[model samples]
Target: MKGYLKAHTHFFLPSEQMAEYLDLPEKTSYSALPPAGDSNQVLPLPDSALTLFYVGGIGAHYKLNAFIDAARSIPQIRVNLVTRKKQWDEAIASYPTFQSPQIHPYHLNANELDDLYAQSHIGVLAVEPSDYRRFAVPLKLFEYLSRGRPILVTEGTEAARIVSSFNAGWVVPYTAEAIAATLRRLQGNRAEVQAKAANAVSAAKVNTWADRARTVADTLTGKSK
Candidate 1:
């Protein structure tokens, strides 16, 4: 295909393994949107009861059941899953943990989703380990960072790397025990969580859509290459 095609562009730089597989050049131009909200807002204090917020697909790949299980051990921990009513119903019917008193499921509009983020303490991205995850950066991760919320993401994905690089969140294995342990760690270290929250906002400032757009414009105008 490389020999047959003239050129192509990537929304993001392919992983080293992927580049090697495709026999791509050593360097490639890349572009990505930054955080999607105001970055100047004051960071919220950690909630008294640890609140984990997840808003997205309720499919099996998300591994939200693990989070539900994790919440079971900590009665004070609250888990919120926001999705469409249909998906919510399917999730509750498929997973018993969805019925837990600590778990709350909601169907929210876009504005309400922002409100939900405001009320939450931590943003969660519990993707199951898979090959596709290596290249994908979930949008919710940026949304979480934009809202100045620290993240809890699974290891071995781009999201984990970003969180680690920015010191904006924790990366843990995709298991109930690991999740529960990390939750406890965050709960005991309120100051640490607050620090991470501040870092998230700082990170968002550098990765906003406006910045990405400027990069793209520069590239098109021969100002950058």
Candidate 2:
């Protein structure tokens, strides 16, 4: 049987590596998000909004604290961060900007999350490198990609490869200073950032879950087995 996990390739094992273990003859690449909003219609973006989303664990390894610190440097841009439960209250206490209405953390539904994705400019991935993450990719990365927003990847290991391959976003050092600098750059050049968003959306069209389904079928149907 094949283990197919969509939208987790940012930090996971390369398809070639996984195929080796499964003794499978083929590998499939898929996105976690559905797809870009109908390509026929060009999605308009917020003029002065920069939304950064983080929707996962509350572990110490994920440096959400640092991402908030960096986000504070950009005044013109608004930061909307989403985390699990109430862990952010303490984290927010340390940063005065979180007290401001522009920078927020809250719970959202499926449609609400999609609305956020549609309106967001960047997605902040704050997970650090560990054994589990090294072999596993976060679904959020693919979700962010599906929306065609630039990614601010916090992990400095395998995830970097995907960013580099797609030229999706700026790679910051695993520190507050680097993250701050990258966010500033993104803020200064919103046009360039939007272009990266378009590029990401374009690339995603050719790489999708439907393609993965076909490959999975071929393997299980005894065509590739």
TM-score winner: 1
lDDT of each: 0.75, 0.59
Task: State which candidate has the highest lDDT.
Answer: 1
Q: What TM-score do all the candidates reach, one by one?
A: 0.84, 0.72
Q: Count the backbone clashes (under 3 Å) in each candidate.
A: 1, 1
Q: What is the lDDT of residue 225 in candidate 2?
A: 47
lDDT of 1 by residue, 53-151 (tens): 988888666667777788888888888878889888887778766787888888887677756676788898876777777766777787788888889
Worst 10 residues of 1 by lDDT: 11-20
Tens-digit lDDT track of model 2 for 51-89: 666666554656565666666666766777666656676
RMSD of each: 3.1, 6.4
Give the Å shift of residue 40 in candidate 1: 4.4
Model 1 spans with C-alpha error above 4 angstroms? 1-43, 221-225
The collision pairs in model 1 are 34-207
